[model samples]
Target: MASPNMQIARNARTRVADRVTSKVTDALKSDTAFESGSLALSARIAGAAAEAVLELPAEARRTLTRRQAELVRGVRRLVETFGDERGRRKIELIVPETVERSVGEGLGPIVPEEEGKHLLNELAVARKIEDWAGTVAGASELNRDYGIPRSTLHRWQHANEVIGLLKGTKKHVFPVEQFIDGRPALGISAVIGLAGSHRTAWLWLRQANPVLGGRRPIDLLKQDRIEEVIETAQAYFDPQ
Candidate 1:
């Protein structure tokens, strides 16, 4: 009953409505994808920044270079703006500064005075290594600090035994001698609680070892030899 022209006009209107709806749906999907991607990227960047900060000496953290502080602040801002508050809370639970300081202090005294000094010097070298490897330090630094040559350091770094040992524990374990104030006491549970990462804890244990000439904590753990952990804990918990 309608005229040909009216039918044509009605068809045109329907097409326009369909196109608008499709476009709106596509736009919403695109926006959601962009938001998710941005959050993920921010999280990765924040995590890396945190790791770098943790590796630095406590004194260095206090006196952070302008650039270093800026980077940390930037990451913090991104995390605050984009990260889910719940997720951020979880990260805080994992790696609190108090735990890091406790582990560092606990491990400090046990390091041979010479080796401890060498590790400090190595931090500068680590800066350069990061440029080449995307990390602040490498096995070479550890090797150099302990007077072990590069090849030996490389071998131990890749050894499965080392990796296993590093993963055996859930917390970072440092010797009492390493304690910042040379405190003679601390509990294993306390040490474990302080160390947020199993690997960091393992590294602390390995560093405290007098043997292996400074092999990584992972390698030591893989070997089923935790004499140092035992000895350190005993010394701390058992005062004559």
Candidate 2:
């Protein structure tokens, strides 16, 4: 019961949606992490495009150039969301600054083709050093190496007062730097709690601080500059 012109316009919109879906899918399929859920997201995008075109006036929807532009904008939005989640996790390892940059740019993918490859290579190297900088130990290792009892460890974890990251099967892995001379370092619990979780604390602890004369917090802690480290952590927790 629709007129021929209306049916033709509807068919054109369907073709635009299909084209956009194909382009978006092709762009994302290269990333293994993206491929899993992308098909479903792409379908949703196509449906959204169809609905959006309907909301436009009939003449606007019939304009091929306008329709193409709309499809491209929808596809870009899809890519941005995918990029943001992937960037948040991987960029933390390669370059922490990239996370802020990505978000500031509206969660868009910030890396160009050549730059992205370079980042991927750096990420591969970073993974190798993860044992020292990013690794965490299980409860048994903590007990053996640092004499931390499972009950006390779990207590801190439950209280959200330690640097244990949950791993496979709900097992918690504590960062090695949390220990010193068979005990948890003084003020570490408070610092961990204050900095708002282990990941943020890890970033603060590992990076050089201008206030500490460019020395790393972990190095100061290793030197038993406990009070200074705590002050630095507090500064980092609530900076000027």
Candidate 3:
């Protein structure tokens, strides 16, 4: 077996080789990457220049000059805010989701307006729900802390007895409040069935309902007001 440092080096090389391969493929596929004199895509492209060929996220591809400028400004703000730490080789910078979206939307061909508006709307809604719901934990955390088995939790998720939100790219997180006495809170399945999705159910449950006199649906369920909660949810979905 290789030494740890040797293994690290090998992994680094593998990652670099993969990135180069991806860049080459992007060059071949991108119409904008064709050079005036160079017939070979591989000959003219490498590093940052080659990255220009990679396709942007669908919502980000239509960014105009103004959008690109927003990204530049965001990065500049980060650098200025951390100017004292600039001497360090690397430092992580955290920014709001809107600024993050600008970074992705800053590239690619300028298209018609409002291309990134949908992404912004989605980000805003996610932020609101996450803020209200709060303190989500993964399956392993719940198993370790609450003594609820992962298999049981997964089963509950499948049954819609529990609410699981896709916290990031792929990791699903359940709100701590979803579990009661090591089991899913009562009436969650009913709400999920009515709402049509776990996320929609959870968001609806957490939000203040006008029919329920500004009381959240989840609070009503906790108080054993299942019938009333279900009726309110029905009214919300129907609204006719």
Candidate 4:
């Protein structure tokens, strides 16, 4: 019943609508790929949808109506997920301002100013002990002063390299007798002797002390002072 030109126009409009709808459906489906272990798929789908919108015919583009807005949003989401270098630039643009706002707002808890000064004094004392020649005393003093558990101090003394570094000068000597008497103990040498290689010693050290950041015991042996190595070996053997 419609004129030929009218029929042609109707068909064109339907085709454009169908194409836009299909693209949106495809974008939605592709978005799920992010949850499916394919990180790149979502980006690709979003890029394609954006391109399709730009390439739409003039008449189709003009008739975009509400559909154009939806397509643009979809493209933006996709770009957010996986846009090229330019997209990353856009994302990072506001980060500095956001950080500034958070700082200005004082986002965290508000303690009394005097309480902060008192905490600093307590921290300085603990730090002084850690820097002294006697690590056990330093650890014990910190434990007592801060009400930190003895077990936690021991765990930190044995497991954390940063704690080790803080406990004494890098050049400080460790006496064999100290190890024998079970003063500063580690069992690296004994474990190595049992396991029959420096490699296994390293593996055990990493497993027992996750804070060492996967460093090998042998590597520690090479870097640490001979006395420190002996002390660490003794502690590992006799961690009581």
Candidates' C-alpha lDDT? 0.42, 0.69, 0.71, 0.46
Best by lDDT: 3
TM-score of 1: 0.17
TM-score of 3: 0.47
Please give the lDDT score at residue 84 for candidate 1. Answer: 59
Assess the local accuracy of residue 155 in candidate 4 as a C-alpha lDDT between 0 and 100.
Answer: 59
> Which candidate's TM-score is highest?
3
**Least accurate stretch of 10 residues (summed lDDT) in model 1?**
176-185
lDDT of 2 by residue, 159-182 (tens): 655667656556667777666675
45: Cα error in model 1, Å? 56
In the range 44-104, model 4's lDDT, one tens digit per residue, is 4545555565667878866664244344445556657653564354434444544443436
* TM match of model 4 to true structure: 0.16
* CA RMSD (A), model 4: 23.3
Q: What is the Cα-based lDDT of residue 91 in candidate 2?
A: 35
List, residue by residue over 157-194, the lDDT tens digit for candidate 3: 88788999887689899998766678877999988888
lDDT of 3: 0.71
- Provide TM-scores for the models: 0.17, 0.42, 0.47, 0.16
lDDT (Cα, tens digit) per residue for candidate 1, span 1-240: 999999987676545544544454454554555575564454445445555565578888766642342444455666587545654544344655564334344533477889889889978543332232222223444344445455553453343212212212452122212222212122323334345433444345435343334454334333543443433434433434
